[model samples]
Target: MRTLTVFALMAVVLGGSGRAAEVVVPADMSCRTEGFGYADTNRHDSSKLSVRASSNGNKSWIKFDQLGDYDLSKLRAATLTVFLHEGKSGSQQCDVSAVNDDVTENIKWVDHPNQENPAEEIYALTWNNAPGNLTSDMGLLDAAKTTYIDTITFTDGVEGQGFEVEVLDILLADTDGIVQFVLHNSPNLLNFATHDNPTEAKQPYLTLRFAPEGADHPVPEDGAEVDTTLAQLAWTNPEPNTPGEPIYCDVYLGADPNRLLMDKVEVGPDVSGVAINTDNFPNFGLLANKVTYYWVVDCYDTDKGLIKGEFWSFYTNDNLPPEVDAGADQVVWLGMGEDPNQVTTTLSGVTSDDGLPGPYTVLWTQEVNDAPAVVIVNADQDVATVTFSERGVYEFTLTADDGDKQTSDTVQVIVGDSPCDASHMSTGEPYHPADANQDCIVDLADFVLLLAEDWLACTDTLTQCGMLLPM
Candidate 1:
């Protein structure tokens, strides 16, 4: 278990209160307790901790302090990074519980008379179907003492050694500046690097991300292209408003970036997102394509008059050329024919375009040469069948033209008298002895056919000699 105490580090703050901020702190003290009811065994200064649940196994505790610098109420996200000392093949479950009282560096293995057992496990790890309960002598306590916080599951089979856990709600539940945690009852033995580890980088640490004071984290991201049909504006507001003093936002939007205040919309604080269509704002109508729109959200709280947000912009989708996929190259085997060897195969072509501007048209054209002419059915349709009359390669192109743009794709069709010949013509690969079934590619399929048909059989010497020519 890793506990991030903010007691000593006051210079770890990254940003101001107007924007998101990040704070990182490391565990201040950690110790492992023997599972047996011993009175005097403690490993406080070890560089590694062994956490498990057997009768003789050990449970660990981590303590962190100095979190009095920042207000915990504004914590948006919290994460804990722990490193495994040694790699393991499978996953294990380690139950993390919040300690009601702080544990000192000289804490013993046995529970004292007034030693308050850890409250109901805060995080019940799900591995090997282990129940969510504290099974250690020093960790056992009334299950109803605390409410269930969360369950965190992690896989131990990682290429590297570091693993992180989301502890936002877990940390928010602890109001006290000092944070303490108990690690016990893991399905498998877990060896974790301690705060006193030789490598500072491997020591467990915690990161906290705080939301800005005003509305932020706009949707669609700034400068992103959005669809006009489902256009909507959204943002995040971390500060909660009081019941009697509800918050209101004055949303200003316009196509001209310099004069964005031309249109103003007033919405309640409960509405985090508003649809940008004609139904909501008849004056704004459907947004024009390829046009950039600028907007800003000014939230008004009774406590703090009006807090203006940063101006954000996004471009509407533009009319794009039809995306064409003239299916894969094909191979066809001609049937027995005397005059002209011929076969027909479907050339499946597909096209997609933004229905802006107008409808689109499709055309199929073949490359004319001295070879026998190929006939295409419904040449204007996307998916059309083509007939090959000669044992040669034929090429056809599918072109899609929208009113604004046009695009094309080509596919080749190979015709031959036999399947193997058709495959060889399509691949252009030289035949090999290992291609037992006459296919151009020699893979495990050939091995399976060879093993199934020609395992161990001997021919008669007389027949073999008679069939051979005089040498």
Candidate 2:
């Protein structure tokens, strides 16, 4: 028959304690002997094996091949199973011992070396009946011969009952990879299915449980470049041989690869993915336009503990928009035949683009309003000129663009009534047709101004009086 020993590596400890793994080894060789030194008589198929202890000491020996690769020092827990087929008598106490002799499948019952002085007693248990006498050592065997690890008690003679024994420490101390065990009941006769049984499913086997392995399959693909500031991180859970165990993941993120600045998210064991954005972390703040970020996912189980993953990184895209800052508002007064250059307001502001190369494009646009304003823009330049035709308020906007993105800012202009209007003075003044000086008196001072500037040919009323009105 073929020998089977399966080794599976589980969790890997990143920065903390080491991880654990599991191994399964099935019995490769087994034989049973009758009382009075009888050799192999029953050539049973691979369906069942038997053991008994009466006047002459009925015993069975089982051994596994090639198991030395497992590091006994790293072992946490282990179990050995013996599948019971049937029993002849009532409750029975069984003695389990480790075989120190070199044995193989070819050996017969009479050829077994340990038949005279059986190997060291490692474990003992009761089997085949309810509330069996577990305290009894049958007086036929001595206790001080070897160390005993643990014991098991059987409640019934039911078929297919697995009598399990813990042998973690015993296996660790064993130098040779060969696993040979001897089973004999001192009080009653017990029968069990062995590796020779035709029903292979009932064969004896051993299982070792340990910590989990490292996480895998990270999103964003390690060192990929992303366009958005918000990123979703994900990874696969470490699979376990013992099913139904809950697994939790802790996500770490930061601009620095070594030190994670983002708040750690305690995700429930049910979820494998998590999202991070500017809203979630205010102090660490939003992800800047063209910055690189590092992240990792640490996986854990309540029983197995923590296993951290390797560090990964991704960069953000750099085609960001420019920022615009329109200069402050301005106010102006009206005058007759006024040259726009004399009262023109400089419409200017600052702009910046953190994206790529060189100077960005700048534009100034005049917004249409109810106010009579003659707006002119030097669209090519960062600063421009704007003039008002009449007394009213005007609004202008400045926009900056960096090919991929654009932004704008607004500024207001207030144009008040001409300051030379004597008729509209706040003070209660009597208006005169020749009030050129607007002194509320309309006297000879106004007349002298009009006469010196050609009063006779002046057709316009305000111009004839030497009074200038806003153009």
Candidate 3:
């Protein structure tokens, strides 16, 4: 149905001459299709990128720099992918180019070999851009109908907001050939220190130096106390704190922080203090119980970039245990067991947790020898003396409530004596001192009391057991 063709030209777009200018083309602007192009999936295999394009088309330009915002030195590499379908071109013919700020040998270019027939291709902007630099990888594929992935790394040039890339010099035979280009933000591991050929190019395209005038980008630590992991750690507070400013707070975590991360946790504009579990609250949770952890801090200006403070590394924590200064508490007691009378006892302590000792209620109850004892205390009293009158034993206990949890304690007391004294009176004979009724003497040696015959038939009614006083 659709057709495809290889492109003709490729260009590197560069920005103006600032520490932030951009370049559209690379070292040598040229296309090489002999043994280069995207991988099996129509994108780059080695570089970190992937792209897609329209089908069956040609005679167009691929720009690497459109609204160039960065310099060339910041860039690491570039690439282009080509897709081939039904087409008219019997072979491939195209050029890829790159340019640096160097005024001398500023531009680099390459072309693809002619083919008896047409096929899909993938391309890259790599070492080949330089005269003596390796040409193993360069432009390899057509953008139309092909997914092209390009990884471009500039010396000091990179993307921020409102940045653009340009690609041109395209020639495709596919009537429907389309070009899709994408940029990757992956790092160039092996080329972190790669620099442009100062002698070859009079005007270098870009230039960006690392921090500390010599050190590389600072490493981020997880244990560090921060307001947030966001690229920009800005603080905002609509209402002020003790100082009166709307947002006055500090981020505290570890000891001196510069050598490990940055700042003293005393950030500004808004971050000075925070409650528990608040988001970006200094970007880190405070370790409980003085559990030391890492921490850092930084500042930002509307005009000046991030003012990264010296990275400090240490172990320090600021956690306190639960406050035990419970306010008011109370207790009331309810008597238990066969006692014909019921009584309630109560006592009140300082307010459980109101920060002020006051009228408080204490509620508690427990089981003693099969009897349930109940108690309740109100805010009117400060102390209660527990007392019991029954023959049973008793235990005095107290309970109170905290904001999230409750607490209690206990004290023991002894009550009533043996209800089992009858067991010691058992005698050997059923007739003698066992007067059965225990009158301190034996009387019914088999004859004693009498009962109505109507009720005496059961168990052959023993004399002493059946005697009933005349009612």
Which one wins on TM-score?
1
Give the per-residue lDDT digits (tens) of candidate 1, residues 320-406.
789898899987788634434667789899988887678999988897764467678988999999776668888889999987678
RMSD of 3: 29.3
| Residue 94 lDDT (model 3) | 27
Q: Write the per-residue lDDT of candidate 2 for residues 61-90, one digit (tens) a residue.
A: 566655666666656667677777654445
lDDT of 1 at 140: 42
State which candidate, 1 or 2, has the greater lDDT.
1
Candidate that would win on lDDT: 1
1 or 2: which has the higher TM-score?
1
* Residue range 286-398, candidate 3, lDDT tens digits: 33333334433343434333433333333322221122222233222224435434433343333244422233345444436543354434322335544443433455445
- For each candidate in turn, the TM-score is 0.44, 0.36, 0.19
Which residue runs does candidate 1 get wrong by more than 4 Å? 1-17, 37-39, 100-160, 216-227, 230-471
Candidate 1 — worst ten consecutive residues by lDDT sum? 123-132
* RMSD list, candidates in order: 14.3, 35.7, 29.3
lDDT of 2: 0.59
